[model samples]
Target: MLTNINFSARQALSGVISFSTCTIMVLLALAFSTSAYATAVKQAPYEPDVAAYRTALFLANMTPVPWSQINDAWADPISNTTDSISGFYALAKRPGGSALVEQIKQALAGKDTQALYAVTTRVMATALLEELSRAHNGLEDGSAKAALLRATALYRAFEDGIRFLDRDGYRSTGLAWLDVNSAAGSSGVLGAGTLETDPEKFGAALSIISDYIATNYAPETFTARLEFNAAPENIAASGASIHLAFTLPPGGTIDDQDPFPMLVLNFEEGHGIDEADLPLVAYGDMLFDSPVIFGEVAQNLGVSCSTCHNRSDINRNFFIPGVSHQPGAADVDGGFFNPLFNDHRSDSLDTPSLRGIRLTGPYGRDGRFGSLRFFTRNVIVNEFGGAEPTPFMLDAILAYMREFDFLPNSKITTDGNLTDEASDAARRGEILFNTEYKNMNGQSCATCHDPSANFLDRRAHDIGTEPPAYKGALAQAFDTPTLLSTASSGPYFHDGSQPTLGAVVNWFDTRFSLGLSKDQLADLTEYVETVGGADEPYQAFDDVDTKFRLAFDELTTFATTLNILIPMKDAKHALIMINTVAPDLAADASTMKNLDAKPDVYRLAGLLNSVASHIKKDDWDAAQKSWNEFKTLQDAVAEGMF
Candidate 1:
């Protein structure tokens, strides 16, 4: 069964009550204010002509009112009615009025506090009468009808000379900034005879507005056509082929009006090629269940794949490193150089877009995995906890990743080659990267990092400097990050300490890594700069690359693209511990009692708080003290409680 969930303003208001009483009070005050609340009504500089307003109002008001009277009043704006009740009834019969009536009815039935508050403060008394007159004939609840009528009159009497706030305020405020423009040269405001005189233009304007609301405001709706069990059979029958379907937004069509294309980006592992299958890793437990640890790991150590690759669209930009770690907390390992030690800091761990990995270089951030096979194995062992994947699964996942092809950018290309002189410089830089130039030290870029293939030396070396102390294991030296997609992947360096490629080049040039003169360094940076986008060749999966397939899938999923990156063993261990230990802790007061038994609860709390304080201040010593204290407490609990 398919169920549609609709979220309304009333629901939003209700949910906020637990966390925000001030906002709730303000809304309540706005609803009850007698004066034309300045904030409640929003009006455009231009007003709709009387006729258009009347027509729109009529349609919005669901109540039945005399059409002839509305038409007559609209036709002669000069005619004034002193009787407020009569004027309200006349306006309440319109479409907008009907919508208000429905809104009130729904609110009352649901006991929506916000809606009731809005109606009491904003709805005109006469409008309430019109609704009551219609509802009286349809309902038998006398008390409810009377209550509604009384509430309406009470509001009307207090109205004074203030104008009723316009109902469109909410919509206008919510949608003011969307980049929607009128193509038909018609202003958004409806005026007298506009709809009849230029129906097409009016329709187009409405269509655009509707589309904007549908795309941005409406909740996403999805329907499950096939169950999870259907996947394995489908893949087995398809052999090497992969199938994909995109669920489009409602009211959206694949046409010129909508230029965006739907694509299923694919990433495959090396071993999968031999077996003609796709690889799948389960990353849900890491992402949702243990986000804290997963987040910590992603922030400090540089991940593979996404280290150099990136997506063209800003929204779909670089994968894990670009999105995930960019905004995370500071580097955990204090900027150490060792490959095994944590050293980076980032915000969110974003998944990289494998849109152009085929065109890019020797893979991985360190370029240690010269061949895709070696890259695949390293990822599984080091990052994914040494899980072996089935050959078919690896093949399918790899094939899917290869689907990401880059669209050419007009700004950079001329006659198929990069037009920017810097790009040509980058080509020269590539040569200097692999070979030593005159006036430069014997050390080439490839001396420390591989440039012909993976762009890494597959070996660690001391970069001759150490960073500040921090939590987590420390590395003796830092590993070199690749420059494959140096142009797009900013905030360069192993710890992402440098903000730009130029800054990185300058640092290494002056440092002990590769001392080079100004001209040599410039040429080197130029050559490496052109290595971005999906211009590189794709690596196919082969029999010999069996081990590489799993590694490739893990790296791709972990860094450049979305697949799965879970270590099943770690997940299983965590789950087992939680189920077994948490219950036992809950059952006996021994765990909680142990704190009182030895160190005492007060002391233990102080120790834990001290650790938390150090963590807050970014003090490694204080943090270590707290960790050690907590470990002792854990041991005490194990002996006494367990």
Candidate 2:
């Protein structure tokens, strides 16, 4: 059975939380304090469904509450349709859920944040009571068990708040839930041996939970409010550490970002690439992860190139409140991140993946820059307001990024034709995709997205996508995006509006009046999914800790480049290497499991700091001495640490 966890906030929050009293207090303090983005709205609603709750919480926890976006989120359930919640039954089926929807609509109409929050929590409390009553009254064991499970999901909405407000109540309530699940028992699979429900046991367990909710969460009793803080804090900052206190623009979250923090490098051999063989690549890897290359706020916040382009691919979860219209998209030139780069327009574009970047550019969404180096330099200096990158820095970063390869796909061959592995529907769709139509001005899908050239013509077109800010404004054209691996990369298009391949096909059909039949549309969708699909689109690291170790090892390997630089007496690039490695070592060491070995890790970092000091003074001998010491210490502890 599906739980209300799994890639959700609860799961993402698990690793970061220490469970200590001080930890809880600190987190709560951050939560309640006026966030950099949050406005006058003191609290967000306690929503029942996890998805709805996340969307609601995201909107409420903005600088000036995005009332428009919040209304759009609510607009889904306000209509007469019911949707699935964690593969359970429809949303309205939950106790008092329908009434809550209506209340949410009314609150949205009235523009009352407090009333919205109150109604949401009150309904959740009442719904829990109703479910408990249904479970007790139900004759069937299976039906009773279902009710208990639904009630458990509802209870989770208040768990964090309850943990904050009342510890004893939290403990008791948690135990009650476990007991109730045990009492309801399980129906064995394949109708083999079923454990019948115990009415006496069930009543005892149910009462503990029911009484707590009635006393604490009843409409009149419930007074607490929920406020979420998603801003990325400088976790690396410690007293005397290289990092400084920094804050995010808005809607920055480290929660979901933590799972896949490790930089994934692909090579011809796949995985194992010696840093010694590719010194520039190694240095570039460190530069990509290092925030020192960026300006003040970005450096302090630890925002680097890797933050948006995780593993040389799109960081789809990257979001900012005012700057982003949706997740996986941000207005890089917006006033929020850097006022100097603001284009004075709210034109938020989807963050395109950098995989196969060397092949895909003429860079930028509009294909504005012909040179990749120029584009990258502009990103550093113009977009994020970082200082002009040094020649070596640019060269190394370019070398690292050029190594990024597209995910391998078996369904499509070199020329982008569907292989034997592709479905018949996909093959049929390919014909339609290649066929030119008069409706599109004698053009076809293949006109822009040429199958022979990685599904792109290396050109930009208006395609009716750009919404002009003014009546006389010219429509902006976007570069033809490659279709490879787009199956996993969505919402599609420049603005991330189309959510699926089918949606994209439907959009084109309507926009150009193609008069494609429903079957033809389905075939076209299948073709795109086939071409875009990959066997393994993402890194296959087992867990977050494993990825953390990999990242630590990579940083250490990258640091070895200092060996060559120190001997050559190259102070500039050597200092860049030192600065990047030192802060990274300090930050990564905190997450290392071998706590006893951490001191040695810090000592190694201190050596880098020493080398940096010598480099600043241009004392090559002293820098080499510190380097030798660092290498000796690293050789001894590198195998055991992290």
Candidate 3:
């Protein structure tokens, strides 16, 4: 685990602290000239640049660590460090060694602090993935696979959080502590939380997450593990499935801070997913966080599902004009511009919460897509301009999505009723929300936004909010979003025109001519902001980590299988592979520089855009040219551009 300390490395000694880390090669030539050059001993499995970074970290720590002395010592079998960092760093001398070392050196000298942090984060992220690949033999590996995958997810979350906070832009604000919202805080829900000074809060933050993963999930396998069977997700619903809960560790409780917090994903009610098992959920989670999929092409631009919708929720930091209306809302179709994918509608949809989405549907603001599968495919390929996702990849994406859920706010019931613990205003709000009493004109809020059904009637409404000349589907009839998640995902409505609950209520009250006192309106807004409750907690699976590890393996396996089949000659597959591989390769840009591919990245993107035109016109030759250019770009990746 790499630490993100603002302080320089600890002074074990001033002696070794200033020794040049770049002296390994020169020292090796002089000290070991007479002795035979010892064969490179890889301490562990690694990709080329990973090996180089690992070595750089090791040598950077040890003052005056001469490669020649290490080489001479390693010549003796008794001096073997075959399973250690020093041994593994030695692999940098192999075919791709020098190049990766050079890349690391640049990062070491680079002026961009955010980029440097991203590089170390990438190393830890890849390291867990490598371990998972080795440990996951098959489905039968069970706990072994789940443990590894969970570790991978934690590492991914660590990497993602660091990228989220820093890569965009972070600075040492002149404050000891800055007021902030918790990750769980959304809209107006859970709004009060605190963070220390930026350096104190951020420094080594990645290491903290990484270490938790190491301590809990570092083991390759479990000895004896618990398993569970699916039960009725709810006694009220017949077909829905329950989350396979786990037995808690000795007094251990799931916390809100857990990135992949143990959510009781009762996805059985939805027919969208085939299995609601832990492993499947974990597999799905990994794919969503991975830039190797939809977020690939935008890797250099810092776009990932995690980059935008962090932890499957809203990204509070993203703010590109047209692409992002504010912090959390974004225009999905703004990712790329091309004829085939663009409808030229220019619709700006509010970013919906993927959490608890298994039950909330009539997908999208237009409620156009009948199934999540179609919605997912369209978002990646058509909206984000990701390469065409294969059917398997789509399924994996949906699997991850089905498990999303909102945390228990505990302030209100599922029906938007105030709990005994609710504030006086919230209680008054609950009364107004559930009341069928109409104004003199016979119009009632509950008639349209039904309380029993998560405050939505499963139909679109004008509500005086529609733009008469809007250019998208059902142009005037936008879907009614759930009031339950209103606290976490707003600026409201299709266009995110309203910034707060009070604003939304004000618009509705005026449109409906509901004459209300200021006190009444405040109470009503409070309930709407605080509504929505949690389902039953999971209490079954004792080995969630193992199950998750298995899922991670399955996800990786699927990606590998699908990606390897990409032939640059096939325009379609080539496009998909480009989206998948480019971002994936770019993920390590922190320490690994793809000098040759860097320029081609943009060229390939332009070529990809031109390809749609050729394909649409059935111009085989033009398409061929585009594909060939793509191939040239890909070749840089194959040759280890980083």
Candidate 4:
């Protein structure tokens, strides 16, 4: 049961959100604003049975609003809400559901948080599973059983919705969710995914809901997801701490947002603290969670890096006005289609997974930039009209992004190691990959991609992956992305033209005329999806200033790639970090730590700051004035400076 939340979105937002100035660090505090990507709509499946089952499934999975939104959600003003509350009651009335609805009603009516939590988590989930068991045995609608089983998953999702695990999907405090395998004692999706098949234990554990919920909800006992964060610094060193000023309590306050005053938590790595460079990582975490960093358009709609890239979800359901091709896809370059923004040509690209990004390079579908720093600044400036990143902020983000790893998979023999115990099918697929069948225009998959290069040749190729109407550069050629963790970032290709690895095989077969049989295609798909992410971190840069240069250059490249004014506020910070590390080098990559050059270096930074400030106000004359002075100083300090 795939759960999708559907709600109406404000339609008139795109026109208003196109341009405005905001810097990444400037808006770090606006982390928990309204969600911009709330399900704007639910499209029909065009089949009654499927739609009914889906509806039942979605209701079962809905979770509580963030604690801050509770009052607006449940207060008496519009208290007749029938969504989750009504859905639970309806499910309780289903066959074999028992009197769980009454228990739930009492819990809600009494405002009994403890009773409500238990009843909602245990009884309702249990009752639904029992009904689902009956459905599976053909005593009831099997579809309803199928739908009811999804309830546990929804309950699980509900818990997740409450926690909203932000620090790379794991938290040092609060409830840790259990995987619970399946009812048959198999590690699978919610309801153990086997309540019907293994009735003896599976059905019983669910039947008593309390039996299983007790183990799952035990406050102090649980497996910590994503390994623990780095420990705090030594006791003598200022007693490591971080400002948890933006935090919402585990379950949120009763009536309103807590406005967490002086809420400080230990500087634990998993709690927005990085043991390696605690301050840098904390700053990055705040920036990542901040929605105010984006232009007015994204802010008004409540979008931010975390909005799309958070622990709970990557927001595959996100949609924006005139920018969404479908639920999971966004047209990043609105200027290409909308004259009001910065009229250009249409260039819709797929969102890449941020995890394991260090291994997955040249950025974007075209492989736009070569590294994370480059890609990071480019996204800020172009996608959000953000102020340039300072050097420190860039490094801070660098530390944070380094924390992301590939989704765990066992197929790859070792982390980032392409070598695997090649199964017979994979071997055959490798043969097909290297073989230049005459029918394929003498093209071989291995010619440009193979395991030796992480299945990416670090180059672009044309396999004609374009629709008849697409005239963009990506339609003909696209950068070869890693097959590492290919399972998650799908519908494949620059435009998300293929939904699965098999679709890629099919496209090669039809377009390149490979004429491969079904068996061959299946073998190829097996190899691609089975690959895993690197087990250890991939460190790309050493000097913070040198990294700043690469990142700044990447942002510059984004401007040439397309015509638009991207307000990157990062450079001001970069300028400072550069001076701290290499004073005489301006932002260019030259080794010089001379104290004599500090004044000139800072002067250049001040000029650039003025440029950023002027750009924000749409004072192009003043912006260009300061920009030219900064550029002159940049060149005078060293060559290759921007």
Sequence-dependent TM-score of model 3: 0.43
Candidate 3 lDDT over residue span 1-642, tens digit each: 234311222221221333332223322232222111011122323332333333333222222222332232222121112233432354344335444444444555563333333343343444554444333332233343344344443233233222222222112111210211121112343655432233233223333443433432232321221111111112102221111111111111111111222333445333444342443354455456544454322432324465555555554444433234345555565323212343434454656656667666778886777788888877777666567777756776687787666666677666656678778887788777656545524646667677677677777766557766846655477677777655655667777788888998887678766777899999989877767433322223234333323332332333332222223234444344334433332222222233454554445445655654575576767766765676665555444432
Worst 10 residues of 2 by lDDT: 231-240
Instruction: Report the Cα lDDT for residue 130, model 3.
Output: 45
Model 1 per-residue lDDT tens digits across residues 357-476? 444435543344456544544443344322343353344334444444443333234222344543556666666667763434566666765644435454555563444356554644
All candidates in order of TM-score, best leading: 2, 3, 4, 1
Clashes counted in candidate 4 amount to 22
On TM-score, the candidate that comes out on top is 2
Models, CA RMSD each: 26.3, 11.8, 25.7, 20.9
Instruction: Give model 2's TM-score versus the native structure.
Output: 0.63
Q: Point out where model 1 deviates above 4 Å.
A: 1-395, 399-442, 460-482, 494-499, 513-518, 531-642
Instruction: Decide which is better by lDDT, 1 or 2.
Output: 2
lDDT of 4 at 476: 60
Q: How accurate is candidate 3 locally (lDDT)?
A: 0.44
Worst 10 residues of 3 by lDDT: 227-236
TM-score of each: 0.29, 0.63, 0.43, 0.42
Backbone clash count for every predicted candidate, in the order shown: 72, 3, 23, 22
Candidate 2 lDDT, tens digit per residue, 49-79?
A: 5334445554554434567766655444311
The alpha-carbon deviation from the true structure for residue 322 of candidate 2, after best TM-score superposition, in angstroms, is 1.3
Off by over 4 Å in 4: 1-32, 35-277, 310-314, 335-341, 371-374, 414-423, 439-441, 467-475, 532-642
TM-score winner between candidates 1 and 4: 4
Better of 2 and 4 by lDDT: 2
Q: lDDT of all the models against the reference?
A: 0.34, 0.68, 0.44, 0.44
